[model samples]
Target: MSKTDHPHTHQTHAAIIKRLKRAEGHLRSIVAMIENERACVDIAQQLHAVEKAVCQAKRTLIQDHIDHCLEDSVGALGRGERVPLDEFKQITKYL
Candidate 1:
């Protein structure tokens, strides 16, 4: 299924987009700093910030996907409908 088809209703997709855009801006600033021969320390600091922002966005997206899609979808498996162990293990890879 397409990404949008996933059940992420509880998480605001716009918030994720905003975060990614912010990270993209930070990355652009870093590139400019490098081209200008900015101080190594200053460049490193900004790079770190950009990395953290991207990582946070990734973590948020994965958590939201698991919380809304995996949990909700698997929950529909009624009584006696066993979820495969392999499927559960695969899903946990994100965590």
Candidate 2:
């Protein structure tokens, strides 16, 4: 079953939100810096920080989904049924 088929909560949700909010704030400041004609180096640094924050948030979200949702998807399968577990590793390859 898909995650959308059921309602559930994730422990990492709050932390992800916090990270996104911080990235949003950094993005806003980056915009202001551009409007103020800040140096390219300074703007690039802020952009890097925002990018890293967003990437980290995404990684945390995906990992949480793998940890919880995948387990739910797999249910009580036999030990030899390792495809879903293999998918857990495959999903992280994108990160």
Candidate 3:
């Protein structure tokens, strides 16, 4: 989706990108730390940050799917537009 749709869209995208960029830096630092044999605590914290970033991205994707995909599905079904009910049901099942 375009960034102009809704505030949630832009905000979520921004959060996701920022998290990934930070995680990228963290990954580089992780490699350096590994080479230097840094403390395990610091490494673990960086790993957790990566995990959180992944989850945040997942949540944002799910939100967009719900907002756009489900909305389109519902509208199509309501209008009896040619979208097969069984197929739509399967699609909605994922949501």
Candidate 4:
């Protein structure tokens, strides 16, 4: 489903996008460093930073989806309704 169709909005969408962009820039710099024959330690450090940023962005997005979309969807269910255990397990895999 599209973001607009989700029951809850992502408050960190903008921040996530910003983080991804920064990661993208970092990746480009790493590529340039490789072409310029930069020191291995410097390249590794930059690569590490890029990986960490991308990881953080992914984590933030997943947490936002769980906290908002999943919670909101389940909260809307009628009193007698039940969410499948398998579905809960599936969602938790992202965490």
Candidate 5:
């Protein structure tokens, strides 16, 4: 399966990347806003939106890894494959 299918690891990386690029643009706008002395609440709201987007992307990636990669590996191990245990252990760090 594809990386995005991994649920926890999987994400539309390209999509998230594009989104992050947009966020960067938003950051530049925020910077401009600061230079222009925009209202604190407006800046804060923009910042919060950026944060939310990033967190959402992260969550999507994590879910992809879990759903696809981890689930498949776990299933394989259950079927008597000897791999995936270490990977499973490694994933715990993210927890």
Candidate 6:
């Protein structure tokens, strides 16, 4: 079934939002640091933190979507059908 037909909420939605917000804060600080002519190493460290936070948030959100969609729609893991190998690979590209 299409997503619209099986509408459901992610269990990790709140945690994901929190992570994104933290990343946003780091990004804004990075901008301010640039404006203040901070050291390159310091700025790079903060940038790395932002990158990790965003990556983690994206991974969590996508994994949650995959898990819930499979379970709710296709009877994944516990049932006979599993998420298609191609579909799983497609999503992993982003991660």
Pick the lDDT winner.
Answer: 2
Task: Please provide, for model 5 over 38-59, each residue's C-alpha lDDT reduced to its tens digit, 9 standing for 90 to 100.
Answer: 9999999999988877878777
List residue ranges in candidate 2 displaced over 4 A.
1-6, 76-94
lDDT of 5: 0.75
Clashes of 5: 16
lDDT for each candidate structure = 0.72, 0.83, 0.69, 0.77, 0.75, 0.78
In angstroms, how far off is 49's CA in candidate 3?
Answer: 1.3
Residues 28-90 of candidate 6 have per-residue lDDT tens digits of: 999999999999999999999999998899989888978866545454544554444445656
Least accurate stretch of 10 residues (summed lDDT) in model 6? 77-86
Between prediction 1 and prediction 4, the one with superior lDDT is: 4
Cand. 6 TM to true fold: 0.73
Report clashes for each candidate as comma-separated counts.
0, 0, 0, 0, 16, 0
> lDDT tens digits, residues 1-95, model 3?
44223333444677778877888888888889889999999998988888777777767766765665666667777998655445445445544
Instruction: Please give the distance, in angstroms, between residue 27's alpha carbon in candidate 2 and its true position after superposition.
Output: 0.3
TM-score for each of the candidates? 0.71, 0.75, 0.63, 0.74, 0.67, 0.73
Higher-scoring candidate on lDDT, 1 or 5: 5
Error of 5 at 13 (Å): 1.4
lDDT of 1 by residue, 1-95 (tens): 64334333555567878988998999999999999999999999999998888778778876776666665446655434444333445656865
Residue 27 lDDT, candidate 3, scale 0-100:
84
Candidate 4 regions with alpha-carbon error over 4 angstroms: 1-9, 76-88
Off by over 4 Å in 6: 1-7, 75-90
Which parts of model 3 are misplaced by more than 4 Å? 1-11, 79-95
RMSD of each: 3.6, 3.6, 5.8, 3.5, 5.1, 4.2
Q: lDDT ranking from best to worst?
A: 2, 6, 4, 5, 1, 3
Say which prediction, candidate 1 or candidate 6, comes out ahead on lDDT: 6
Please tell me which model should have the higher TM-score, number 1 or number 6. Answer: 6
